[model samples]
Target: MRLRNCLYHFAPYGFHATWHHLATTHHIPGRIESNPSSLVRALDELETARALMLPRAVAFAAQRRLQKREGRRVPAALHPWDSWGCHDIAYCPDPQKHPAEPLPVVVDRVLGACAAGTDRAGRCLVCGREDWDLWRVCQNCGVASGGRGAHH
Candidate 1:
């Protein structure tokens, strides 16, 4: 009932998926009481949400899959939660003020290089093919090599 009550407030797919997960995993008994109409409504809501972001979502999904194939970390997708409470501050790096180089920052830089396929001498991010002669379309999405979230 709580879920049904909440479902009325939003599109239905999010509600249904959320409800199904809650019911099956958390064993919420009220989900069983929820009717098929509610499930259909939830899916309709999902379709609308999907429509709003179809182009961007498809690109992000493709890039992520391509990154996985090449054994690289997909650059993190910036969801709303990524910047919840952060103050926007300018970077002021003073070598004199902070003597100790942060190890994690250094490691992150190294990891970023690896993710971009730069360390191994121009390795393609999508497919593992080396030289241009072997090149067809980028193993990544058909979008330009760097276009990650253009639609968003």
Candidate 2:
């Protein structure tokens, strides 16, 4: 169903809005009722992002469990859960600047770009632009990237 592209997952932003944004950015249609199979693009992106997040999530969970056992009330990783489902989440400040690439590829590029120890300093996590402002929104892509660390 067309509504499959519009879902409300347990993410920080409603996944429906995120899906619509991504769909529109990627030139995907809002109504797939005509063919029905066109809905796969949005779902594929979501699934890929989930696949990328799963390992980190599991490790984070294990770390949290260890911390609990160690009597650490707060997560030492700093807002570890704040980024839940942030991959491809609704942070597109400038639709035109959002990459036309897939979500996993964008994430990988951002990871590599930020690997030089620039956690929130140089590039836009989503768009790979070097136009971050005060709140870390990319002037190029308009993504409030939550910083490279959070975005990744």
Candidate 3:
């Protein structure tokens, strides 16, 4: 399960590595690499792989969450983070910047902040729109409210 999850998440990287290996090992022609047919075939393979892997990944994630909720211990190998504490999945761009807190907790905090209309709320600089979502994306201009644009 852990292996499947990791493979699903890192499929793109694996594809690239495989492509490089085939190009080098089999002496794949540069002309073939540049060909539209080759590109289409590679992309088609990637899409097919994604279709196959996504369902399994979703199932594993759901099972893990369910196990956690049921007070059952998920196997250490099945954990999102590895033994060395490195993330097995690449969901977050910067895990350190955004710790893996519960979704409900994060949602509640965001909702509360938006409800309170705290310092995070402000006008959108792009179009001077006041309405913004919890993510601070302006409803009026669809731009992010940040820096001097954000107001209390």
Candidate 4:
């Protein structure tokens, strides 16, 4: 089968995730087709192509992040074929950028004033407890608060 055909068959996960799954699984070539050796060789060739693209991918992500930081709008690729390129560029690590704040620290700072009753408007939606900690559930009635679907 053509590589493009195989790609179409596995397109639901996107190319990266599909390749990652195949690499991690290490299944035999015969499992995919009649020609066991050729299938393995084809997989290896695809992997090599992917490896060659990594540096460019990383650089592109870093550039996108820098563009976002500078308050400039990102330019769209000229070609429709390239339009669906990486959008999760913030997940990439850049040496020039400061490390992200730890989740616990952020949560603490956000909830600290609320917990201490400094923000009087902040109250538990479930128990209506003004004194409850905002970082966790309502301390009065044990109802979950502050994350996901919880009302502030």
lDDT of each: 0.34, 0.51, 0.37, 0.39
Off by over 4 Å in 1: 1-17, 20-34, 61-77, 80-152
RMSD of 3: 16.3
Question: What TM-scores do the predictions have?
Answer: 0.25, 0.67, 0.35, 0.34
Superposed on all Cα atoms, model 4 deviates from the true structure by an RMSD in Å of 17.9
Write model 4 residue lDDT over 72-142, tens digit each, in one string: 99896321112223211111121222112322222233334433655335664333567664444444443
Mind giving the per-residue lDDT tens digits that candidate 1 earns over 1-152? 44456434431112333344334433444545655455545444434433443344456567768899999976764332112111100011221221122222322332344346473455433333354211222333221122212223
Name the candidate, 2 or 3, with the larger TM-score value.
2
Ranking by TM-score: 2, 3, 4, 1
What TM-score does prediction 3 earn?
0.35
- Candidate 2 regions off by >4 Å? 1-7, 10-17, 25-30, 76-90, 93-97, 111-117, 131-134, 147-152
**Higher-TM-score candidate of 1 and 3:** 3
**How well is each residue in 1-152 modelled by candidate 3, as lDDT tens digits?**
23234333443223233344223433445676455455444444434544544444566677778999999988754222222121211122221222123222322333234335563445432333465432344444332323111322
**Global local distance difference test of model 1:** 0.34
| Deviation from native of the Cα of residue 131 in model 4, angstroms | 74
Top candidate, metric TM-score: 2
lDDT tens digits by residue: candidate 2, 68-114: 89997954543333345333342454444454566666555544444
What lDDT is reached at residue 68 by model 1? 95
